[model samples]
Target: LHNMRTIQHLPREKQMQKATETMELYAPLAHRFGLFSIKSELEDLCFKVIDPNSYKFIARKLREKKEAREAFIEEFMDPIDEELGKQGFTFEMKGRPKHIYSIFRKMQRQQKPFEEIYDLFAIRIILEEPHTKEDCWRVYSIITDWYTPIPKRFRDFISVPKANGYQSLHTTVITKKGRKVEVQIRTRHMDDIAEKGVAAHWKYKEGKEGGSETLEKFVHWVRDVLDNPRPDAATEFVKDFQLNLYQDEIYVFTPDGELRTLPQGATPIDFAFDIHSEIGERAIAAKVNGKMAPLRQKLDIGDQVEIITGNKINLNPDWINDVVTHKAKSRIRQYIKQKERQKAEEGREIWEKRAKRANIEISEQDLTRIAQKLKFDSTQDLFYDIGKGSFDVNELYDVVKQFTSKGRIDDKEDEDKPAPVTEEEIQETYINAARSISDDKALVINGELTNVKYSYANCCNPIPGDDVMGFISRTGDVKVHRSNCKNIHHLIQTDGERIVDVSWAKNIDSKFLGAVKVIGEDRVGMINDITDVLSKSLETNMKSINVSSDSGMFEGILTVYVDDIDHLGRIINKLQKVGGVKSVFRYE
Candidate 1:
């Protein structure tokens, strides 16, 4: 369907859109299935329709040189054909013409012109399967004996077939005429698999029409993408579908020396996830080639990766950035969202308990009122903010106080009663207050201090690593702020005694939301590239991405989850390297 040229009869706009989809979708699918002939044809047809001038120019060049190229191929094959027959092998030799898209890609990649392109065609040797390996090597020996083989251009796929089951012995040798010609040696069975891909494998396997369980896994993976419920369903499906299409597999080894196959760019985190969800969740670090490496370190063809798991299951949100596989990404996202939902629930409980202690009944009506007072779009948002320490609990109490006076009277009576509170009593009160809400500590200082209800200041967005101080508010809750925040001076001068020392708990592994601004020259696909870079970093989720372009310049604001300032810095540095990106800075 992609290779069809009849779409030209349709309207130009429709033709171009359909052509783009075919190239982005069908071409990669063909490549993944090892349908190289079809893949090349699809690419050429799409390229012709997409960029007719370049296609015509390259086609014309090939046409002008067709006769001489065929003659040269015959000259290159005759001696080898005779020698192979003399060596007691039954083989068929044929000329393989290079596809126009393949030539165009080479020119684009090498930054060369059409006239400088060499090896416009190849020679294929198909042999009987009974003695396939021996005969293929025998043919290789004959060819090398006749011509000088390029050491770097040799590939022995027979010993290591590709992930798509493509097996061929490929070599590029210099002929007597001092011109390069590629040679492919394979059996008839291998040729069938190479052309028909999964279909041929199913036919030969004598299994169900679909294929083996292994092949079914691949089919199911595709179905998973198509079934993924996303807002931009088609676009996301195509993006993920194409992502899996052109991958070259890399085989890595586990600690037990068991071979594990992963996509070429997969990292240790991906490897851990492939092993098991538990292993991936507990993976704290990894050692590649017996040396400590970052989780994002790319694995090579045969590197041995040893995952170091922690006792507690604490996955960094950033692992999504380093992982390339759909499974890893999906699992990580699921885990993070689950944690977020749990946190939101915890926050809801905190609100309910606080309201109860304040002698206020938090009915649905009260929640709606409080949400409106806090400018929250919904009660869930209000709870999430309270849970994430983004909302000041004192303000919430103040708003809810207006709805009832039952808890206010108890507080007033307690205040009026002169009670001598001892140090031990105060400590017990704090512990009881902390225990009433959640086991998770609300605030941790130099020591494990609890019962300190605090909300993060929006002015500084103080994360765990930041130098922070807490300010006691009217309702006894604390409002945390960065020590160096601009608003801290007024607080320091006016209420220095209320400032409390605070630090993140040693075991706190939660993520904090941060905002960043990216400035770059405006160009097509710039936003996609920028988001791709972000997606490959640690636990970085683009909560929102707003891009504005003017006068060929683009500026984007991205709000994402980050572990700390250091995590944000790593993300910024990565964004800086994206094409056309001029600068990346944290938005205060």
Candidate 2:
């Protein structure tokens, strides 16, 4: 405590790690042990360490006028208690103090001072026992009687306990004082269950009669990580289990009365995955609340989810981004990788068969060595490149043929051909590659062949999987452009003979460089500060960064190399965590 000061500083990575460990770990553990008070305290401590400025600012504001804060809580609780009493809920209602850490986060995110952060405080409602499940509904109905329910804000976890085995009804209301406060309604059993989390289920069964076996079964699933074999296999299990332990859940249902518990904002895909991994894998579409919706559709409380599956293979990698649950996302990534590996292996086999048909004899070692030199890890990857038509087959054949024959190879082959010496020859070669409909080099846009003419568009850095089109050039060659590229619209009137159709390959290898401009209020070490955050927080390499400041505002442009769209998302999340970042987004 002596070392604690009015101001403290630590590397942002340390703060993130501390947050992941404390708030995401020990706080949930304390809750599992029925230590409600301790769990809240732990969370507050974590917030304080992670975002000190906001925490300190809020503390000072609340402490400045103790009576004002007390009056706020009283005004916050009056109507809630009146509604609970009128509904005959045997209950206890009270307000919990706002933790320093939480206040700090609110201040930082909202860019407000301590005095403006009022929602940090919350009111809790703990109810007495009800002999039947209907009694739980009775409590819910009672609370809604006095307060105008925010349609999307109500959560009914009583029917289906959360992945972490937590169950409760949570809703928020605007008090007479125009202050918004959260109200948590749960029976005595639920109160105990909520406070203790998974342990409440275990203790209820092992130490008391009339405990729930259903909850016990769920607890066993929660502990599957401990019993699982490989660390990789259980990483998701443990991560999802821990991260979701104290989450806010919504109750969704199936037509068969089977209940599905989901984190707030979960989609149909998440529900399907939660039900079973295969179900999620095959799920192409779904009906939420009996209305057909896209797989990305969000599920709400009392939503009846019906998944649609098809015999055709349509498990797309893009689905990974749409899923909300950690379990769902992890499973999607796993399946996509598995499918890619299988394709690569099949491609390798096909390439091997093609080599055999071509009378080319090469050992697996020869193929593996050549593949490694070309940035591949295995023969399958080499074959995958071959199957995807990325590598020149004629070149690959010569390389392999040479490897098997002690470097004695044909000197007259096109593999060693010199580049065209004249512009006319280059133009003719380009025309042949473009105009030859049977050639793989011809730009086929969405499977349609057109007159050869097109050049690569500059804007948006169009890559594979992106929608694209070809523009005709006066020189009788096509210029390829993303369909949405801003420059494409201006070039549509070019020579018709040069306008050929274009499309992206099924797989892409090139890395697209993206830039982001971060603007915020300036402070000491602000430039070095952002650099440290980017270097440490992000996974990909940062190619270049430029920072400048004048008139109290600091701004920087960060150029990062991304493996793909998914990696870009993680980088965006990291940038959003930087201090004083007024805005962080794509540069162009």
Candidate 3:
């Protein structure tokens, strides 16, 4: 339901998007539930909005054909009327033109021009209450005797009503003038049920005996569709749902003679899934009509299907394209996703092993950059490729080494031209410029006073982009403490209310002092290599660097300027890859 007032408030693009989502979801659901009126109206509105040119073309074609169609329908129904009158059948007949969207679908389905399609309307013959379905069949025989009925075009839904309780006799006959016309025969009660679906089912069958069983089966079908797990993709789900539940049905059977109804074009694999998920997963082959057949063979009406199973899951992802049922598709999608996840994990382990062997210590942020540079949608995609053997891990290692190689990039740019810097360094430069406006830009304090002095706690030396909490001290100052600081454990427990939720501001620029301990073999130029990696490679300004040696082992702690946690991590990674470096750890 599109409220004009509410829709007017949205931008044109957003309105279009909402219409797409509705068409992709609710419209197919309406059709599946036998709500023909609602489904047609919904399709009409969505078609106009989604493709106005096509809608206009179909509407114009329908309008142009209306008068001629009426004449043809009249000529076709006259002989049937005379025959029914002679047979003394109480019936109501009318020529119902097809809906606009329906005609368009017919044209597409037949792959023909609009004028070439002759069966544009159906003449309905609704018998009165006294005339039961048996009489309707007799009437159908009389009509077919007068006209040449196409054997393939006849359906006896009156014998076995549709899952949604629609009962009718449908036939397409060719007249002497070589014009084709469609006809429908049903009782008045069946007509009502066909139009109004469940509502009329309960109304006409208030105390009826046979209808209770049909209604129970109909209810069960609905529950089966709804109660199962929903598919992840909405568009795929809607298309598959329509194929499974709304389209023409084929009645197949098991070897035991039990009947089953599946969508037209359903494969034997779909029959396997309809029986049980376990059977579908384990199905290896199939037998149709007491003869061995391929599992992908499409089933037909009255075809007996038997599934041959194996001990292990014999499912293939390619079967997703062969089956038409939603349950089968959903199960196949789950298996595909599970396999991809396994491959992705394997890829990650391979990458980590290669990284360790190459002495390449890197951050996730840098890995994400390499993933983006490789034109992957996400790091997970990159890893999946690696696990599948499509991507070379050494290629990723080369990218990481270049990323930490003094902020250098190996793209096709002039040697003197400025290479594209990483997002972190760019954000740092931008934040340095933006923070010049205000001193309190480093930490945003809600409802803070003008004289509220802000200071970084010495215990953790919280920096920009560090997770922190603000505590109001007795000196009327706001002190920022790192979220993981051991010193704040007592403060959070004793004076917890004084601790307020705090986060780093994006514009924060001021540097906080951080310290890291690095241990390596005591060798010549060990301290120089560490200092050079910090001050020159990563561009970190060191406040102090101290080292002490015992025999051939040495450990050193360096206090340095840090803009954020990520910056500190990059520093540690750079130091860990230095020559003779055994380990590097940052201390709070």
Candidate 4:
């Protein structure tokens, strides 16, 4: 539902986070257990949001060649159809191109254009019950006899099944017409287990002979993935797990003669993590087959690896690039992140002391601007520099004072740029009085602290995310305006005494009015599509949708109740993706 982009109740930030989790963890997990059907669907759905342009390109290319590809597949399978019929083989044949995401990845790996991909097509041949393992081999022999088999392209999983117990005879062969095609031959029972993954495995588990080894391997593989607890961020997790999904495996041994399977090119760090999380974190040195070798050395088949541990945890950040498994990389990154956070906390304490001693109070918005001017991507990074002694705290105190003394922002570039949905930490505590806010609910704070009272100026109607200034009125209430608003600037220069420091409260419990304008080619169902996106995707409530159409062109103003500027921005972005909608922006 979230991937469909219809679960709009989730904020854009949350949606992005969910999409990343699906891409990095869930989809690949499905693939690991041979749930290709579910895996491919999940990939395509998440791909729509993660990289829309690439998804559209692949989908469009597939559609354009659909008819031709179908004809070619029919022509290619005709000979096999007749041969199988003559041999009285009871089989079901299916011809299909690979999934959209797999093809895109293939293009990326091979560094080739979409048109140049030859092995995009595949055929699956499934035989009925009573078909023995020899029958599968006979089918493979028949196919190879018909076409030239590509070396290293054949996998006889029937003989040595995967950890998931997926058994099939896979081969890529060149047809008489000079086209490459992948082929899979399996029995009905094997196909069932392959399609259903763990579910089918257990279904056939009862009274099944010699299934214990395969089940143990399956359990171990799953345990290996769960070795690392979920981390703060998923970037490293995704990078490592993708290798598990596609890369070949190598079998290694421990000192106790226990065999471990790892992704090809996996290092000692990966091996240690596979054995146990403790050994991976406290790993000091490793002996590969009783010989001291660098941890970065790639393990080979049948090599015995012994990891050395110590009392102290010796995790290296540089090891992030050295390990191929997700567990090792995730643990290393978590360590670095935890250390950085500690430094940032220490820096925050230092800043609070300096600010309190100097009698200076700067808004979170102003601090962010100050951080950017000092070439920091985020305020946390700036403070991190301070904590590590790389940056001077007194210098920051001076910067904050300068910003607070300035009545308003004078930089035109800063005012014109859109306020991002950035997360920030404010030194001051905010009051939970959102229900007392006025109709045009712009966030307000820093007005005598506890008895804070403010309303948005109708002229600009600045929302929570927009950089704003508060002007004290004769009525003892603050009137907030966008810092760039001409009304606020005039008052700042003429009666500067009323210009007071104001920033958005950390939380918003009230809704504000925002107007969005969209223009596009007019067509049937276009209005419905736009409305569904606004109302359903983010669960945003609308006051009214005023629209006009002429000469097959559509223009509309979406008047909606939004929590903040960031919420409104999310709505506009979603509107921009509607099929007939070409332009979407906030209408001031």
Candidate 5:
């Protein structure tokens, strides 16, 4: 694919597509397999096809300065070549040209044009086998001794090969001509691997006893990428492949000093998953370099990491954004999907129970009818919506009634019906219906009343701070209501003696369910921001939160557990300040 991209006579669109494919596949594959030379060539070829003018301009300048560059290289290598000869070191010297892609990158990164880029060419010293390792270092010392080496630009890869298994000694020094030049010293074996990578490893390992295990690991990882079952295989494979190709690897140590390698920008969560599946799932936080760190904290090379786990796994939906590894993302998504399945099953059960209470037997036909009435694509979708609180139970009940009734009602007549009864009126009807049953039970005043059973009116959902009253039903049980409840006057007019003064206990510790309604302009991340605010408040337990949006406008209802009116008010006040919220008020 990479070579195909460089065919200039091909259509520009076809060439670009080939370039993209090469970037998505071959470039990363080359990098992973330790073929730095091939990877650099592939990148430069793609750059040339993508932007021919810039590549031509850069190439032209480098060609124009070819003579001067050769002269500089000769001047830089002369003293080192002579010193190595005097020291009886057998070595081969070569000039390494910097790839156009690398030069282009330097131009962009340093915000400089071609004229400002130093080290466009480098010198490599390849030593013979008899004293390969020692001679490589000896040559490095001789070169640095003859010139002033740049301390920061020095890299001792011979001691620590790169993650891709390229080993060399690299240094940048000022030559006699005051020009900066890069020098790479390595053995013939290392040079072969650095140039041809995994291919060379296999090609040259005929009689070698223990072959490159690092290269073996790289090959295994590539196999895994090919074998994994991804959700969207082509797109996901391309994305992950590109990530592997372009990112640098960071090596961090486990508590036991076992080194773990991860891509640059990988978080501790990725590290934990890389260690073990269970460790990643149950990870609550992390300790990086002996200090507590967030799960999303990016790791650095040589840092020690210790994963912190708890009894329960913290597989939050937000974890997908924090993790960069395919394994972690796959696990988190699977867990979330399983949880959704469970919730949908639970919602189905709730619907079944409601159907039984209404004396309606639900069959597949009934479910299909209800699903159509709700405008849902399928019965499963309807159940899932119910589970997520996006569908109302009362509306579902009405749908069931229509299906079970003796006669089909005319839709136009239903549309023309009078306004629906207020919640207060519905509660009044319930109280009136209970007037015929007589009982001797007294109302419980915050556990003060014994041998008595009472219930709260759903209309008001009154809490500790509200003025309260109790109504004695014919069944003799008491029903509590807010003193200012809309039906209070009617109840007093019909059965004044039934009304009794009621108060919450002075030190009640119980929580009451409160509802708040919010109106806002719909925008991305609004729900996340709202939930973040609610989660931060102490003792705030969200029972249900439902939001609906239409044409950029949104309305939401949040039901929560609160201590009293005051606690509910505090929640409302906090919600009112959230961005995009137009109004936040208690719902009666």
Candidate 6:
């Protein structure tokens, strides 16, 4: 009933509402089905009522200048028509102009004014008796032979149709009068297929609809995205699915010249996965046009892509960040999860190795308890971190060494390490054990003070995993400095006796503070932009920020937690990339 109201042409407001429905719902549906022509038309129709002035002006001008437009079309068609006629090729010609919405969209994307936009019109040619692949190439030859074709503007969609199964031979040429225009050539069947898309298949008498399972799967996916109950959910899904749907497809061959369709930005990874899931899982690298290319390389039309596979597992977790397609991302994530599971099993082996190396006897149950204390959901997640370089292996060794080295365990008695009698005794004992009595300021490591001790240094606060050294004060208190700190060498030289060995504690939960200074052009919303960059873009929790502006420059000092130097670098790099940010550097 609602669909019928949309087509019945009711009141102006009703028409507007219907168009909106089409834009929000059907346009995306069309895109999901790879029906670019339908999607574009729906967008154009919605824009007509949404912005009536632009629509009216564009339509009125095109019609008001109808004779001129048709004359131009006639001229555009004359040479191609004459050439095809000489070659005894039968075809029909049609002129098409840019709709208002498409022009507006182009204007918005290019950030250009309308007057600068040319080629707001195009022409299409439909050839007959071009059912075979050879016939399509023959048509291509006939068209190129007659006209001075623009190499960049030519598109051979007949061989590689748009995602929606639309096919054509598209080219652009400059007329004798020097007016630039686009020309699209296709067969009558191809034109019909272009217009109605999958619906066009329904129009055919043959069983075209049941022929390809891939096509049926694509259509079903499109309907699923559209039929989702929540409007917002449908809208979100469409945005992702639409990119794949509306893009012009490339027909690339395998090494054996078998054709495959990939979207414009599709890399070799996309191509590999399209071929087979296992093949994609094993893909290590790719060859494009018979030369090695990065997996992220943009594939051109008719460019062959060959994926290189390896027997050894080598899936990079970072591949998840680069893939544009959901399929590729999902597959990479699956591989990462599998790798993580394997790592979790390996973490046990690693822990056992550490125990043997230190001549200590500990079981997996003890590691599990420690892992739970650290709030890890699984021993695998913890071990995966150890395997993936997120967790330091040496720190695990040091921590285990410290705890096990001077244990008062009675070697003759094995009672599974009895628990403390009370919670307070556990806390008190933990605190006393954390601090050394002889130094009263040093934290003992492996039963020795080692030369390093722990105290929060005034210069560049250090964390558990931070590379650091201890500076012993005159009062016998330890002061820790980052190992790279410039003040450390001078302090050690002056007070060598005060220097001690220090390492990050294994189970430390203390937060270390760091600051970033952002300098940018002072403008309205500048502060908001900076705050958004920190909070939203960088995902840093801003405890306190102080901003000062002078001479068209904005400076902000942000205090945020530092997991380590790498985390700090990631935040700084993100801030540096923000618009209008002149510089983002560590303040202190």
- Scored by TM-score, the top model is 3
Model 5 error, position 55 (Å):
1.8
- Candidate 4 residue-wise lDDT, 180-274, digit = tens: 89999998878887877777766656666355557667887777665556554554565666777767777788999876778888899889888
Kindly provide the TM-score of model 4 when superposed on the true structure, using C-alpha atoms: 0.53
Q: lDDT of candidate 5?
A: 0.74
The C-alpha lDDT values of all candidates are 0.74, 0.63, 0.76, 0.76, 0.74, 0.64
Rank candidates, TM-score, best first.
3, 5, 1, 2, 4, 6
TM-score between model 2 and native: 0.53
lDDT of 6: 0.64
lDDT for each residue of candidate 6 in 1-588, tens digit (9 for 90 to 100): 245235446533244445555665677666655466766777776666444545665677667767887887886678777877787877777887776677776655754434446677878777766444456577667666756678988777665555556667777877666778887767777777776666665555355423254356456545432343333344344554555545555667898898876666777887886787677778889999999998777787678888999996656788765655545655676666677778867776776677688687755675555565455766677788886667766666665555566543323443467764663454334334335324323354323543233467777676555545565554444577765455764554344434444555544555568877777888898778767876787677777889898998877788887666567778888877777877775564
Whichever of 2 and 3 has more lDDT, that candidate is: 3
> TM-score of each candidate?
0.59, 0.53, 0.61, 0.53, 0.60, 0.50
Query: Candidate 3 regions off by >4 Å?
Result: 1-25, 46-79, 82-88, 107-115, 204-212, 215-232, 356-365, 404-588
Model 1, which residues run further than 4 Å from truth? 2-5, 206-238, 344-386, 390-588
Q: Give the TM-score of candidate 3.
A: 0.61
Tens digits of per-residue lDDT for model 2, 1-588: 111222146332233344445665677766544456567677766656543433554667667767876788776567657775776667777776666665655655765444455576667777665534566567566656755666677666665556555567778776555666667766667777666665566666754534566565566555532343334555455565565555566778887868766777788888887887678878888987778898887777788989988776567789876766666766666776676678777777766677888888766665666776566777766767666767656667767777667754333331545864674455345556656533234456435544454445667555444445565453455666654444653343222233334555544455767666777888887777676766776646778988888999987888887765556656766766777877675554
Candidate 5 local lDDT, residue 421? 78
* Error of model 4, residue 6, in angstroms: 7.4
Summarize candidate 3's per-residue lDDT along 279-356 as a digit string, tens digits. Answer: 999999999999999989999988999999999998899998898887788788878888998999999999999988
**5 or 6, greater by lDDT:** 5
**Candidate 2 or 5, higher lDDT?**
5
Worst 10 residues of 5 by lDDT: 407-416
| TM-score, cand. 1 vs. native | 0.59
RMSD values, in order shown: 22.1, 19.2, 26.9, 16.7, 25.9, 20.2
TM-score of 6: 0.50
lDDT of 5 by residue, 11-94 (tens): 433454455456557877888788887788787777675555457768898889989888877877788889999999888998
